[model samples]
Target: MSESDPHQSGRGRVTAPARPSGKGGGKGVGEMIAIYDTTLRDGSQSESVQFSVEDKLRIARRLDLLGVDYIEGGWPGANPKDEAFFARAKDLKLERSRLVAFGSTRRAKVKAEDDTVLNALLAAGTGVITIFGKSWPLHVTRALGIAPAENLELIFDSIRHLKARTDQVFFDAEHFFDGFKADPDYAVKALMAARDGGADGLILCDTNGGSLPGEIAAIMRQIALPDVRLGIHCHNDGGLAVANTLAAVECGATQVQGTINGLGERCGNADLTTVVANLLLKMGRHARLGVEGLPRLTGVSRFVDEMCNRSPQKNQPFVGASAFAHKAGVHVAAILKDPVTYEHIDPEQVGNERRILVSEQAGRSNLVHKFREMGILDVDPNDPRLQDLLNELKELEFRGYQFDAAEASFELRVRKALGQLPEYFLEQGFRVIDNRMVRDDGAWIMGAEATVKLVVGGQPVHFVGEGNGPVDALYTVLRRALEWHYPAINTVTLVDYKVRILPQALGGRSGTGSMVRVLIEWRDEERSWGTVGVSEHIIAASYAAIMDALIFKLYKDGATPAV
Candidate 1:
């Protein structure tokens, strides 16, 4: 076969795992589910999500490393970027998954052989091709303004044309569940058309994303195709994408189509991170990645989020940061003794860690776990000093210092309490000047300029910086003074910053002097951390957080102070 031949295009093309012949109640590796990732296509449909060809390629490489079975690259003729992506993806050495081209069925009057859509799929040079067609009668008559019979013909001809060129052809029955609910016979006919035309897989899509678990299970059971691979693709419009997907699997669907972090149009698709974890750990079903790939699930989820320039949801199931976090005293006590008492699964199994959040509600157990999380070994958990630290933590929490959201700040305080933290720099003083200026547009604009004096390596240094805000100016000035002694500080940059004002009930004033809390999230090339500061003056509070963030970065990097 030629290099571009569909029969030999993919590096590794794996399909359904064999079903166990003997009826033993063992749910083992025999049930293999092919993971079809459409992050480069469907996920990009999300509002404000526009992945450049390079971004899609990078994500594809990352997904390959994470062991997805099939990667739906994109619709080759849909846009210039997607076409460019397919051309460039050919150069990538993606060794683990089959690359699939996605498109729609042939146009109403267009012949399948000469159809632009089918031709693009073939020209995309992928081993697998997936095309979506209207399964719902409403879409055939109303949306496409075509007769139901003609839509079926489109599905059949489109699949048969692509199947002639590609080794594997997948038919996505768009709105299959809703269509079945509307007209059972017509929906089944649409699926039958694809099957008759030699599609390798039949992917039933919950396009409207309104199907329930029971609905998916009942509909899947009705589609009794012998010797055919059934796939499930769900949307989260009804917040039941994951549930519906699991329901279909229980009803015998073998392939799963989704994005990395539940990213898609509207409410998003079923999160593959959640889906894969549940399949391997809870349901005993297997994906190509299997148990070995489970550990990188969290990393994969976060990698997609990073590519999207979005924050990973901390409360997301399975791989979320707070998935195994404990804050309540009672829960923390039990968790410290036995993690299984609270956590559904070991966090390490998914490349995530358990976090013990410290707050006013926290107890000694919270401190112990927090200490362990920071790798603070040799500390006596029963020591009286530990109680003192807990009391101090509670008092700080009472003063509106949220340690739970700012673990980096908590770690710094705990280290300092143990006399283990090194003082990286001493703040001499800082001044920020806010001025109103008239712009060329005849509008009043506000700007800030800050002067920071700091003693780094025992030498006093001063610097001036300007920005649109006081906090930015301060950070700019401070980073400059510190970077002189710690050049590595340049590697670190601010990721996010948040400020919250305490209410009057929390001992905060109503005016400009109101007590406020600042959270500064920082990131280096390696990892990200957040620090917190609280004070009546916003600038003072911001300075405290910035100082802690800089100190923590330097301390963690093991930078030696010149002093």
Candidate 2:
């Protein structure tokens, strides 16, 4: 590290003409800004996000379908799982993406040909290879304990060595942004070393994730190198990875390296989810992401989350559940009239839909919109019943019911108010018993039994079920009691059950007596829906949610409507 200025914005400097965004070059509207996905490598580095080899393969398949240009699988020999991934990925047969193998430049004392790291990269059997090397003078001197010149040789030798054996090679200038600020001349030299070594592209990394957009644009303008073929790899520690990447693009950088949902170590990497949408929709630029790929953005986002065993972020931009939801009465009314009034692009363009939430803030327009969405087509803005429905919705919301996440229950309520719902079955009450006993080994065994009596098709039915808990027992017995009458109920299963203690429901009671809210996600082969119930007793709350789910399923499956 040498000359530095934390406040220096690289302003007024002329930037070189932009190169083709991908190695397969083209310019203008037809040219694509290659999307380089590192989710299998970098995203797996996220805290608590460990992808199995199978998970990596699944994600790679999905990314290929989405038409990303490059997929960096992982460092092959860095770990056993990555090794397995590459071996398994050999048969992956990606249609749209070229598989990439990642590694570092040769170690300080090692020759490029003999370096175990480089050998492992070649062994991965990928068509493309990307290697990172120190760019900062301080890192060259301290981190590598070598002269700056020797480090340059290491980078050049590593790339040239791989280039002779492989088709294409890329150099990731680690800490390039920070290094440029410290010693602008040395950082540029690092990229030059890779270029001279026959590297296809030079990736500038904001390793510290602290660089601002102004700094990125300004620094990019300072790079006067020819045949730059630049790429930008940003991290999100400063909450500016997406912004910085876009800035670099504005200054002529082509390829963008990031992970899905911004998953990575520490704060995270640039979110390809936001980057892709902005590139195609906002900037009106092109990418290798296919013609139909843009609409599948939300599906890809959620699919990655599912593979990571993480829940989808509702408030995430573009593809989030709440991105298109309008709750304010004024906003909903305007959006209903013309989505352009409140939305940036059509939600369907990104594989999402608009939601008009019915709550205390809602008005006639919200109820009318929501009722129609639930198939109550007769709802009118001027109808008195719309007002009554709105009042009931508010009252229910006041009692701790959230309709947005639990739409099945909300749909059922709307149908009932519209006289479109008929009683499919009647509950004749239920009983649950809990038992615990100590075994000879001093271990305690626990069991719960529930007896449910329901009158279905005017016939009384009784069933007893056992489970590890009262709620499970109740659901088992109740679902069993209904399956005989409604055979379609057999496909319905409880996929997820969530319980929350709402102190506000008990007027600010935070103790054990606080009312509980239960939300259960039910799914069949076709689709899934969420149902909710709130009660002072957990068991009762569970029962209410379970019953609502069954009722909703039966109703949708052609249970006779009221005469």
Per-residue lDDT of 1-563 in model 1, one digit per residue for the tens? 12342322222112223333222112234667889999989999988888988899999998998999999999998899998999999998988988999999999888888788889889999989999998899989999998877787888778878888879999999999999899877787787778778888889999989989988877665665555788899999999999898888887778999998899999999988988888889988978887888899898889888889888999999899889888999999998788989988999999998888889888888887778778887888788888888889888888889976788899888998898887777778999999899999899999999999877778889899998899888988888887778889888788888989887666877877789999988999888999999999999999999888888888899999765
Off by over 4 Å in 2: 1-31, 290-292, 453-464, 505-508, 560-563
Give all candidates' CA lDDT scores.
Answer: 0.85, 0.85
Scanning candidate 2 in windows of ten residues, the lowest lDDT window is 1-10
Question: Candidate 2, 312: how far from true, in Å?
Answer: 1.2
C-alpha-based local distance difference test score of model 2: 0.85
Q: Look at candidate 2 and give me any clashing residue pairs.
A: 1-138
Which candidate comes out best when scored by TM-score? 2
